[model samples]
Target: MGRSPCCEKAHTNKGAWTKEEDQRLVAYINAHGEGCWRSLPKAAGLLRCGKSCRLRWINYLRPDLKRGNFTEEEDALIIHLHALLGNKWSLIAGRLPGRTDNEIKNHWNTHIKRKLLSKGVDPITHRPIDATDCERSEEKKAPRCPDLNLELCMDLPIEMQQEPECSVVPSSTTFLLLDYCRTSLQMN
Candidate 1:
């Protein structure tokens, strides 16, 4: 069977919450602390849904929230974190104390995107907006083989040999080494 609805939609109030509603919600929360959100609206005597109450408290009325414009430092930190973490707003918000994931997400969409564009940075890829087509294609292409350096130098024991010698092994020699190891393992 399907799950039940969170609340009686017909009976619940919608649209903007009034100052009185905010006050009542705050008062209820302050007195009892934030308990089960599913029961909070009923316990607080609110005509709103639990989700609405939780959002209102978390995004608006929370005491520890940093109200006002984000600082320059915060902007840089958000941009840096966004580049490192991509669209993981909750993880980004964790790095910025007193900022909510919703708030950061909104700020990114409304402000940071424009700011990055103005600075010639692609907000999504975090790459230079003016990058050449060749550069862009390079990102899409498969990785090339890495250069292999197989130089070896060894000193022989006094009774066995003369001076130390250095030799450069070919890249193909790596396959031989692997085959030798496999054969030695099988023998053992």
Candidate 2:
């Protein structure tokens, strides 16, 4: 089978996009909005391939992009959304207005991971997935549910147990049920 070519070769006086090239790409996009990325390079008359052009436009050239550091609310949103959605960056980006998937992913890796690690939590599992937390939580749970099995976990609804966004619900309602599960089951 023919393998996919490694993305439109680089460093041929093409890696560093010039202002003139950016202008051409922007103008072309404005005149005729983005479509058929594979044909974009030929149509735009740029030395770069379609993929490169697309990355540049989406990541940097887009006028709607919100640049600079993320705010505290944005950070909370990321953590909250991550706990709910896992690593669905695209989905998370959809919730935050003006944020791009790339930006969100970078923020998650560089900043979020560091914070979680410091808090004695695993970045991947998010639920104390680190070795120490894993051992400790496991030990804590073992005494409580010596007979618990995968079947029980499988029977539970994901929204009820794991989805972080569900925390938004008022505590006066079914949230007490959630709290009950946390205390009784030690899920947190």
Candidate 3:
């Protein structure tokens, strides 16, 4: 059933790869190139299982991966993309070159999720950064005089009234607004 299993029986060898093993796997891939991972170990003369070799190459050895802390811009992009795409980490990773799905997923859960939450926004809904108990900021204030009706609005203090109403506006606008707000507030 299920072709037995992808990895070999346990306790044989696994986890925390070493330098020499890394070199052999890397060299083998470079020389012959990856096709069938099942055959890769035999060709590479490594004791590790084929699945292990594949995981190491994809998750670690790949040249395209971007190592180190994600820059501010990248983090901002990830947040925006995550908002639009949800927990689809692979798709998010696709948008940002050199970033891995696992890396992106980890960054999302560990960093971005908490950051969004700290700002009082629901990461999933991308709603206003308010506490969990806080109700929605009320339906869009009926758009203050609907079209500004300058002729009809002149009698009332439109500027004063409109300013406060707008200030109470919900942040359910663009995905980039929070990021922009974060940058502006931080810079100030």
lDDT of 1 by residue, 74-119 (tens): 9999999998888999999999989999999999999999999999
TM-scores for the candidates:
0.69, 0.62, 0.67
lDDT of 3: 0.74
Best by TM-score: 1
Of the candidates shown, which would achieve the greatest lDDT relative to the real structure? Answer: 1
- Cα deviation at 88, candidate 3, in Å, is 0.7
**Model 2 off-target regions past 4 Å?**
1-13, 128-188
Q: Estimate every model's Cα lDDT from 0 to 1.
A: 0.82, 0.74, 0.74
Ranking by lDDT: 1, 2, 3
Residues forming the 10-long window of minimal summed lDDT in candidate 3: 147-156
Q: Is candidate 1 or candidate 2 better by lDDT?
A: 1
Q: Give the runs in model 1 whose Cα sits over 4 Å from its true position.
A: 134-188
Residue 59 in candidate 3 has what lDDT?
A: 85
In candidate 3, list every pair of residues with a backbone clash.
Answer: 120-129, 120-130, 121-129
- Each prediction's number of clashing residue pairs: 0, 1, 3
